[model samples]
Target: SQQGEEDPQALSIQEGENATMNCSYKTSINNLQWYRQNSGRGLVHLILIRSNEREKHSGRLRVTLDTSKKSSSLLITASRAADTASYFCATAERSDTGRRALTFGSGTRLQVQP
Candidate 1:
């Protein structure tokens, strides 16, 4: 599988702080996506950075992609306790044709304490 690898398996911080997570992959991908899961429930799409793109931002979320390094990072500003969750990065093969067969990283567990 082409699942990406994440670092800092776990993280903890107080509310109003910022949370940052990273992902690394071995193979080429069409795009990299960041998702958040609360209590191990469903995943919520946070951002998607295309291989050709360098960086993107949405609301309080900022994502940076380094295709040369095959790595990506997600940064959340002013994090809140409600932001506590697991963040995952999934890689889609360059030839993917709309399938969930994507390989996902182990994910970073973030804890935002109030």
Candidate 2:
């Protein structure tokens, strides 16, 4: 099973609408983060909410984490066509490799109509 998994595989909305995505994991983590990708290319970090942090927001995005339930959610406000991309939640486990590696969820693909 994936360390992090997102639900509602895809979503479609219009500009000015709101989009929400959810992720669930199976293990303990030091932190959880959200990322965005366009056209399946490189990802850009969006927000990071530590295990101890319950919620965080940046610009039109809001993220919430529930360590106890091992779940997280992301909300995009006033969606725009520019926000048409895949949103992912990733977490890093303590690795013996001595380098942190991210385990990404399946991801939520958002389509915003202009």
Error of 2 at 105 (Å): 0.8
> Least lDDT summed over 10 consecutive residues: which range in candidate 2?
92-101
Candidate 1 lDDT by residue in tens digits, 1-103: 2359887799999999998898999888889999888884998988989889999999999999998889999999999989889999988878746664678
lDDT of each: 0.89, 0.90
- Clashing residue pair totals per candidate (backbone < 3 A): 0, 0
Model 1 scores what on Cα lDDT? 0.89
Predicted candidate 2 versus true structure: per-residue lDDT over 14-76, tens digit per residue: 999999999999877878889999995999999989878999989999999998899999999
Each candidate structure's TM-score, on Cα atoms with residue i matched to residue i, is: 0.92, 0.92
Which pairs of residues clash in candidate 2, taking residues 3 or more apart in a chain or in different chains? none
Displacement of the residue 43 alpha carbon in candidate 1, Å: 1.2
Model 2, residue 49: displacement in angstroms? 0.7
Candidate No. with top lDDT? 2
